[model samples]
Target: MEDLRIKHVSLELSENQESHRTQGFSSAKLLVVRRGAPFRVSLQLQGRAFNPQTDGLVVRVLLGKLYVTMPVTFSQSGSPSSWRAYISPEGLDPQRLSVFLQAPASAPVGAFRLLLYVLTQSSRRGYKAGRFVLLCNPWCPEDSVFIPFEDQRQEYVQSDSGLLYMGTAMNIVSRPWSFDQYEPEVLEACLSLLQVSPPHMKNSRRDYLQRSNPVYISRVVSAMINSEDDRGVLKGRWSGDFQQGMHPSTWSGSGDILVQWARSGFSPVKYGQCWVFAAVMCTVMRVLGIPCRVVTNFNSAHDTNGNLVIEEFYSETGKKLHHSTDSIWNFHVWVECWMSRADLGAGMEGWQVLDPTPQERSKGVFCCGPAPVRAIRDRRIDLPFDVPFVFAEVNAAVQTVIVRQGQALSFSTDSQRVGVLICTKAVGFPRPQNLTADYKHNKSPNSTLRSRCSSVSEDVSPRTDASHGVSVSLTLDKAPVAGEPVLFAVTVTNTEAVAKVMKEHLDAQAKEYDSSPFDSFWEAHSLIKLAPLEVKALHHQIDPALCEGVAGECLVNLAVVLEDVRTQERVLAFEEFNITSPQLSIQIAGGDSLTPHTKHAAAISFFNPFSVPVSGELTITGAGLIQGKVKYSMSALRPGGRVQQQITFRPNMLGAKMLQASLALSNNTIIRGFKMVSVNDA
Candidate 1:
């Protein structure tokens, strides 16, 4: 480990501008060898600015064919105090040379000398670069194999503790040595000297605690800074909304307001059904200065029937009732917060749970974590909070015909409790109380009704002039499940000037139409019209047995057709959607690579997202995937393990190359990612 000499040679730069600045030569060479041990030498060069043409630069040592090049151009510009350069061949003979170089014929010639030194770098951790001493004894035979420092790596021992080294020279070394001449024990001992081990527990408890409790585990998990500086567990834009007055508190409050705003309506929009709730909770906690994030995921929650009912009511009802389910939760976004002992005391600590709609709290809790005990945050509170509310206002008018289909429909009112007027053409159907009270001045105010409300009364003969018409509407009582039969009821209203004529118009159509045409023909005329209203009621039994353990999703389609003859317009009203499969989940495996430059194989698994089983191919994709087969592997992954195949990269060429590949599991599935590697040629 000692007696390795190092010398700093002067660098001479000739005062010539047009000379070939890059040419070089060296003035001397050094020899290193031991009689009975391995003959090896390493040079550590520290070069300075020099003129290559006249003051040439180059080195030839050990009377061997090995040459080290020094470009005058880079040497003059490089400011590093020193640079490392080594020469060693495992099985090569040793010799020395008075290495020197003359400038090429293309440029001016001058004189210059640059700094240089030689050293043998130890293979141990924190082993400073220095000269190595010979280990051979003179008593050894002359024919003994002489190995170069590079070749002697085989002689270096592998330490008991596994540690891979990035060699300064011999870079293509492989593992599990195949050469029979290699001595594993000697190699291990040599490596043992190179291995580094930190101190064992000085004060067992204190040292143990230092390792047990990380200095910044929570900080790493909840930080929102860039990946280089921050090691947060959760990902995505959970932290970016703090600006624009969108602090967690403001955002959460706004979401809570939306919930309260949707309740009071003839058709209340179903808002606040997804992240709305989580947004509120996350905001409230964030305002309290807690580091929190929302994560969406899915799991099975047992239903009252004790059968797992993948939650579908939230989405179906949202879409059908409100005309949209855009911001609905996909998996189920819940908030995770970094909690401390003090926070825990508040009963809202450590990833608090705020599932407000749980019917069976235990069942909802079942979906929280695989191991329910592990998922518990704090003790559950069975008591209910003030129910958040929302509201809406709906307005409408109604008209009726006496002789034809004597059905009634309602319209919005300005009364204490909003209610609609029902209009019909039947002879003895009582007048609507609200309407009767308005028309107390006369039992049948034909002129007034014609001018104001567009009413149709039945009494006189048929006439050419009629007052008004009616419209029919169909709407849903609530969202229904897919694959279920639905019962929809309708409401009709009539308003006309001439009651007798309105009756006659209905009579004419009644004789020509069956029950089916009654709804349609009434819708066709504005004079003897039908204002339709309908509510949906669905009843269907879901047999899990039908799915055969595979996830299945069904989309229910509903349509109501109304034909208007006066306007010649066909109005089709319907809502079509998938009852299940509103959420999707994917599990990726076998995607671990120590470094970016290396190509690692991986497998991706796609799930139905819902508790139901779905059949589909999974697509896998990766960056720096030099070669591979299959995107979504059908192989079921082992728990806590991965299903994977190998991808290889041979760095035969230098520079950066992108490694990317994709898996096309099913027609709709695709997964991808990438890695990087760097190589140096000396």
Candidate 2:
């Protein structure tokens, strides 16, 4: 018997216009439709037309475990022009089959295959017709998560530049977090990551939500991306020493991370920090058709004890002690997913925060959030899924303590210092949107909404009243440069009527941008009596040797306290600065434009201004422009010498491509350079 052939398959968006059409049946030609939405598919069959009453034609669709069969309905009068005119050897028109399918609301998301079969009086045979994909409906009101239509398109559908905020409020660091989700490798990696069950979840059977819920998928992704646990896909090791481990700059996009994880057979890939983890999570969520965006919280608090207060103990000379459990990060990056909370209930639906950084544990697992952003803003600590944890991250009080001779001399609490700039990528654009105001209530006194979440006030440390007589100001010498001294100047002015005796204390500490201060780089103490209207300047210099471990970017927290000897009143000032690594200049040799399938060269130059020789490795990577790893090692570079290297690559894809070069020095220093090149089709 001859096998049946499918001549054409067309997807009808409406009765008036055709949307997608393919000449033959194939999985590559997919028809995408939302669940609960009705879609029509038209298939033109090769060979002589058959009488439906006698032929018994039927179409069967298979999606995962779901299987359904329906009778083929054809209209002879409204058939396609080619279908009505084409005649086979038997002198009859070819058969045209059209079927309208309505995917059930609970239908699982997956690829659906269609098969055409005929049942005669004796035997039956089926031929593969076509395949399509069904996605959950974000438009349906009952299932919609209330994300803006444009956000759903730009954030969830399109892969492009994202924003990751770093550093503290005083020194904000903003950089582009590239997703590159449109790449085939990235999509495959996302699908693969979703399928891998975490260690704790292995024994427990997964339910429908566990398998298909966006919240569950996002939570699992958070844990799997970081290899902190046995089930993690990437082994995360943070080191300022680049020669000791993988550099975060080595990977250009999330696709690179995912591809590496997959190639290693789902083993822990390499390395990732907060920003890297958040960026990769965004890529996975977007590829899985979940609306997601990266968010950065400046002065983010890590309140380990559920008390919304981050305590910092400082020595008299101004060294931050690491004895306390509570701490504050310069900045922390995480992702927010938009989804309806069928598990949590109605009002909780919307943007849910998911942190893949693996800093803290939620539900005995090394994962955080699926915590509703609405709950955080509303101070709904009673809600499930780590609501209190996320709330403290954005609305915690920062307490600075001055301890001398094993005694607590003074303490100051600032409620507004933590969570300074909460930012995310602007909807429909690459720029950042400062969403700080959305997460916290307005500080204005007359604002009525400010008190609605007043229940959170009980958990925070009490704020001290500001002393009106004395004013303190702290300023850094310049934009902090690595391998150089950082000078901090503290100026105190006394506006009181009489001369006052005061003791001055200053503390400078180097800390991880996403965690608490490691150790104090420098500290100073002095006693000075300033007369009325008198101003005094106290300066402290942090040596470059003390900051040697400061790799790419280091966070320095400065605390200055002045105590009036007679009254015992203290004036406090705190400042944070981001010390950036020395930069390397990368320039396209000729220009920034290239033709597809052509070779191009770029020059990377860095000046060794230090007395010691510098030795490191240079890594160049580009998504569509370069194929594989291009690395060069520099053994030694004499002091006061300028070194230049050339890198050549061939472009395979045409578009705007970014070529990034990172120099990881053996002295625990890393600097990055970037150049944008446009590739045109030849």
Candidate 3:
């Protein structure tokens, strides 16, 4: 911190005509006032051109503690414009004043201005502006210098956070509303065939697992039987051998064959089985209205023998890779779908899971629920632009990209040379149930990943070809084996070789995209927006004529529409705020007559789930505010205190009135509720 300092300042004025006015420090003899002394000061103008009759005047003065003051001034016959002010010792520290005298509207038009003189603890100074020359002369000779105001240039103010800079508008193809609309019928047909029960063959024994999609599961079961018999399409199977398969569908009980099938599909070489099985399952599930898709990745273990494999390391070295050669990880894929209890059976109660091919290895799947996607948009900067390659941007034009199979994407672009790439890696069934939230205080004492982990693993970058502008490549390493961390990286570089590294970095760090008001700072930047509002003194009941006991509740549907104050532009499509008014549990309260005016006290609460604080009015149409103090509190919120109260709404009488509540939030924060409850009115 530095000590406050006051310095002497000065000003000069000139007119468009060849006349000039110079005052302060040159002609005005102003006395310096003491820091704490009582005194008196006055400014008496006397120039003939300073006529209040012809030139109207405005005077402003600043003195010590008095700061600055502006007042209109009228001219006199003897005294041009006189200003008298009494100053106590408190007012004598630093005194300054500004005077503006303009030529009267009735007077002849020309250049006109004002001059101020001051004395203070800092220093003595003079300032001037007007059409008159020095010595109170409006018309001196043409020898004086005059500078035009047009020569001055203005500078723009810049924002510190880089927020003022407008971001590039991303160009995307106008895609259909849902991913299912773009999918081909072939995928579903394939799935349908897979779901059918197999036809009985001559001398073929009946299989026990009868409930499954018999046709598809049976074909797979038959393949296993053939493999076990030492004669198969890909290779002959042998007893107690790694190449053999489990005829799970032929087993009577809930056999472990599924788990075994899952394990068998773990190898990078044999991963095609997993992909095909998953694709078929997804189609079958979708056909059954299960809403399914597949997600692919790599695993590093073998089913028959517990062996380790690393593709990158193995490809380089001449060492013979041990165990059965099956690509389970490279082309790995699994099914994801929203399933009902009837669809998944009794044991699969919570979130849906992948049906293990060999009826085994299903227990190892983790993080399989709906992983809430928190997208943090970041632009790339400081990228090398010298590399030669085709570049294009890809994004799902709709609000969200729903994962599905055989979905055709709409592609549009401005650059003819750049190719748009879309590589459907796999479908993922991320159940929202898998998410668990934990919070640490801002001041917690814990080291980052660098300080905690013994050795850091390097990132493995996937390769892309020259033709594909945006395509995904998968690489599954098997050496480290199962239970080890699997690293995946996706990079997109334009023809200029400028990669969105910063955006990628931000994406890697983002954990959740909370569509809460507490998160958006009242700004409509994200796709999803949620806000909570309150309804007070809700009258709950069923019509007396139709009622038995009090059972029905009054429900109110509310919508919030956000608008940009600056642009006055409304986001018509997705910009909306909605919350249902709390169900008022109205009771009969021992009332038999229809005219009974039963009293009730209730508070309706709403929350904003976006990162920004939202502001809008709540129209209290159904019920008006009663006579009482209005308050706010939060409900069902994460750890950090994230709630605030808006202004209170007090009604004169009990009638219908629009109770409007405006709300806003900080960036990356969410405000949960604005609860409204009325007290004591039946």
What is each predicted model's overall lDDT from 0 to 1? 0.22, 0.66, 0.22
Better of 2 and 3 by lDDT: 2
Backbone-clash count (model 2): 3
Name the weakest run of 10 consecutive residues (lDDT summed) in model 2: 446-455
lDDT of 2 by residue, 1-682 (tens): 5434456767653331122111111212345555545566666766445554555566677754456676544432322211111112233344765555555545555556877676655547677766665555555544344355854554554444454656544444445445766554555566566556563245333323344466666777777778776546566656655554466655556766777778878877667788888888888776655678888887788888888888877765556677688878777888888888888788888888898888788877778888988788889888878888888998899787778777887777787878766767565443456666567777322111111101121112222223658877777766566668877777778887788888887777777675567666677778888888898887778777666566356777777777788887776776776766666788886688888777788889998755588899988777667766588998799977888998888887655566777788877667666665777876
Q: What total of clashing residue pairs does each candidate reach?
A: 90, 3, 97
* Global CA lDDT computed for model 2: 0.66
TM-score of each: 0.20, 0.78, 0.19
Cα lDDT for residue 41, model 2?
Answer: 60
Ten contiguous residues minimizing lDDT sum, candidate 3: 158-167
Task: List candidate 3 stretches off by more than 4 Å.
Answer: 1-196, 199-277, 306-328, 340-348, 355-682
Q: What is the lDDT of residue 600 in candidate 3?
A: 32
lDDT of 3 by residue, 35-146 (tens): 1111222334331222223333223432211222333332222221233223232322322323223221112111123344433333433554322211111121110111
RMSD of 1: 30.5
Which of the numbered candidates is closest to the native, going by highest lDDT?
2
Residue pairs with backbone overlap in model 2: 227-234, 234-269, 318-507
TM-score sort, best first? 2, 1, 3
Which candidate wins on TM-score?
Answer: 2
Q: What's the lDDT for candidate 1?
A: 0.22
